[model samples]
Target chain A: MNIDSIKNGYVIDHITAGQAMNIYHFLNLDAMDCPIAIIKNASSKRMGKKDIIKIDIETDINLDILGFIDKDLTINVIKNGERIKKYNPELPATVKNIIKCKNPRCITSTEQELDHIFKLTDKKNNVYRCLYCEAKAGK
Target chain B: MRHLIDITDLSVEELDELLDLASDIAENPKKYQESCKHKKLASLFFEPSTRTRLSFEAAMFDLGGNVLTVSDANSSSASKGESVADTAKTVSCYADIIAMRHPKEGAPFVASKNASIPVINAGDGGHNHPTQTLTDLLTIKREKGRLDNLTVGFCGDLKFGRTVHSLIDALSRYTNIKFVLISPEELKLPSYVKKDVLAANNLEYVQTADLEEVIPQLDILYMTRVQRERFFNEEDYLRLKDSYILTPEKLKKAKEDLAILHPLPRVNEISVAIDEDPRACYFKQVLNGKFVRMALILTLLKEAGTL
Candidate 1:
């Protein structure tokens, strides 16, 4: 509540509240042992409202998913109270995995333990394509 | 490609390439019979589908490949509460490629995420079937001589028919094609499909429940099984069934150049007497499917540098 800051960690800021949990699962923050603070529906003067996740430990996350799911995620990694590195992943040229294809008939949509792989066909539009059913993806 | 989940994946050019390859395979079956000799095709069918399952197996074997099929989800680890992703991952390790069918919406997409091999969707709930679209494309090419400028009338089960949905999406790409949708009131084409695929493309189409009213207007009559369950009352199905049947009497009204197609294993939706008609090409469509699938395996593998 006091703008609770982490001693040494990263903060994923400026995420939409609606897509916050999706971004959370995309980054797999809960699976990590790091001390984390996830603040959802935080009032923001710039964007009216936003979601933020602060990690209090030095942990590397799979940025591929974060970039695919929510390209707007702004990651500011702080170490010793100084910005060590920041990752604002650009739209990846191709999506390896993330955001499952919505077509149930897509081979990726099957119940078997196969990887749900999709190609990032249209980056600006966030359009993905299932190789099996060939359905356009992303809501 | 990582997944053959829907028709939108392949562009018109790509679809033609696959179809061309299929035609070549069909023309010269012995030349490519052992094409996928050592390759294994794993079929993970969570839902029961005899036609699609057998088609996929037959396609793979026709290419000299073996199959590892799991047709029953109840018998698989899915009954033990395993997710589709986990099952597809483990199956990817054992097979060169996989074909899956599920009862849930978007189930194959979940499986393809964990699978390493090429994932071919045999079918899925009521979503899409790209391969079937490929088969339809091939059939169209063989029968109509071209995909363009043909008037295709889909009669029956457009609301929940995966084939209808996929074929609509695929056909929307060609130039000067017309659609005549003939279905009972309870089973008209979904508005979303009309909005997204038909109207958006500025394609011309008309909707009518009276099959005979417009049977003569069709260049292609694609029939589908109109089940009693699709109706709220058995009486309505009985009333509608005979009206839509592609009997010899109905064929008289159709054009001489018209081709009658049915994605077979059809019930009473099509009369046996019509099979002798030169234009009744449903059986030819089945053979076209096998050829198209063979072409698909060749083209995909060729692109992957595996064939």
Candidate 2:
């Protein structure tokens, strides 16, 4: 399976295995007209197996969602078929509308228009809690 | 300048100050009687809450302030589809401070974001009841004489009891505080709370099915009602309803000085017979609720430059 490398685009690498679909959905990659390739269970030296997403366009990616989904993920900017910049996404201090609060009694549940915001309460444990209901964000 | 959306919103120093103010008010009510003489409190209760709503109103009235109340959403413009933000903005225009009780967890937060005044979360769903936690703190301090180095036992529905969770969160910050969680398997404290608040803080806690087993070891016994509303299946609620009823027989093993606290409106979790016991402090908790509210109001008003 030889997928042509993009001349100028972003390669989101080191996604946890089986999480490419989640990233795809979360980033709304399907809505984009640009060509995108999701390689699942790809061989990796650091990670036993990982997923990589390649977007064939210089789209403004939401690094917060990428970091929240997989903290170890690396984003590579490819220019003229060569990697120009390689950096890891930082976990955002606060995230909005990325994940819904599951607590039934949370105000976000009742008020549909409100953004589902979560705060990174415990950085060491990678724990996020809903800003409204104080419910821990589920994996 | 700030809102009391969660118990953590108030720092340890702030909490101590509030507790001190509450103690002062309890001892000498006349000194702070006119604290909010020309102020107004908007009681925007989007849900049905008898105790919390009344406590806020009573506190404001005691402070020589008038209260503008909307007891339920049906009675307010909310029935006509007014958003919480809009309601908060409108209420802030009429009142100096707002005490909002909404069935939604983050409703008070929304109100606080939109309002110009301080927003007190009277009770927001099962997420938080910071004022109740404040009352519990004051009660613990008044009863135990210290918040640290005490083994507190929380009995009954720990999972759905917002007060129990809030108190546990508050107590976890103090030194040498151990928790003896007594509840049935169905009503055990939520794993998130156990993990986030207890484990993360490295706080000592033990889960037990028998309240009797842990009674003698506790310096404080916080009782909670097994709310029928929280359960989806009535049969499960019925089975676990009487799991930890604190009768005199059960209290035999408890310490003589054990401060039995309950965020009241109790229903059989604590036997009426134990009410005569000197350890019973739920009624005192109710009065403390008012005092704490008064303290909170004064502090918030002062912070907002309204007083």
Residue-wise lDDT of candidate 1 within B103-173, one digit each (tens)? Answer: 77566766766787777767766666777788888888888879998899999988988788889888999
Scored by Cα lDDT, where does model 1 land?
Answer: 0.79
Candidate 1 docking class: incorrect
DockQ of each: 0.15, 0.76
For residues B1-307, could you state the per-residue lDDT of candidate 2 as single tens digits? 7789889998898899999999999999999888899899999888888999999999999999999999968889989988898899998889999999988888999999999999998887767889999999999998888889999999988988888988999999999999999998878999988987999899999999988888999999999888788788999888877767889998999899999999988878889999999999999999999999999999999988887
The residue-by-residue lDDT of candidate 1 on A40-98, one tens digit each, is 88998877888998888865555656666677778888888888888786766665556
Off by over 4 Å in 1: A1-139
TM-scores, each model vs. reference? 0.71, 0.91
lDDT string, candidate 2, A1-139, tens digits: 8888898889999999999999898888899899999999999999999999999986566556777888889999888789999998878888888778898877777678888999998888788988877788996
How does model 1 score by TM-score? 0.71
Inter-residue clash pairs, candidate 2: A107-B105
